[model samples]
Target: MTILNETATRTDRWTPVCSYTDLLPERGAAVLVGTMQVAVFRTFDGALYALGNFDPFSGAYVLSRGIVGTRGGEPTVASPMHKQVFSLVTGVCVDDPAVAVPTYPIRVTDGTVEVSVV
Candidate 1:
C-alpha cells in the first residue's frame, strides 16, 4: 500500500490509470492504485478529476458509482449509496462540512489519464 505523506514534497510519480477515451463525459470509473480505490471523472468540458472511491457516509467503496454534477459551479459527485455530494476538486462534502474525501492530482497526457497516489 502506498501512503501519502503530507509533509513530503510534490515529487511523486504519476501512474497511468486508463486511456482518456475510456472515460465518458460526466461519468466516473473506478481504478485501483496500490491498496486504494480511486474514482476518476471526466467532466463535460473535457476536464479530469480524481478522488477516493470510498464514501464516508455509506462506508462503502461506491464513490466511483456516483452521479457527476455541479453545485454552485463546482464540480461534484453525489454518492450513489447515500447521496452525499462531494467536490471533485477538493473532495469536500457540501452538505456536511465535517466530512471530506481524499483527492488526487490528475492529468491527461497523450490521451492517457494519470494519477499520483503519493
Candidate 2:
C-alpha cells in the first residue's frame, strides 16, 4: 500500500486507469493503480476527481460509490459503506479530520484522465 504523510517518491507515467467521462455522478468505479486500486470520478459539473477505493473503517472496496459533493467549496465524496465523507482534493475524511486516504495527481490530457499512482 502507498504510505501517506511521508516522503513522496515520484514515478514515471502514472498508469492510465480511467477516463473522465467514465464516472457517473452519485456513482463510482474502481481502477488499478500500480497494484493499488484507485477510484476516479466525474462530478455533476463534469469535473474529474480521484481517491483511494478502500474504506478505512470497513476496509471494503466501496469508496467509489460514495456521494460526490462539496463542503465549503472543497469537492468531497461520502463513503457508501458508511457516512465518512472524504475531500476529493485532500482525501481527508470530513467526519474525522485525522484520517485520510491516498490522493493521486490527476490530470486530463487530450480527453484522457490519468493519475499518479506512486
Per-model TM-score, in order, reads: 0.90, 0.82
What TM-score does structure 2 among the candidates reach? 0.82
lDDT of 1 by residue, 83-102 (tens): 98999988999989899999
Runs in model 1 deviating more than 4 A are: 1-11
Kindly list the per-residue Cα lDDT of model 2 for residues 1-118, writing each as its tens digit. Answer: 2222222444355566665566667566788877888888777666666788999988998898788888999888889887889998788998999999988776665556667776
Clash list (residue pairs), candidate 2: none
> Which ranges in model 2 have alpha carbons more than 4 Å from their true place?
1-11
| Per-candidate count of clashing residue pairs (backbone under 3 Å) | 0, 0
Residue 2 local lDDT, model 1: 27
Most lDDT-accurate candidate: 1
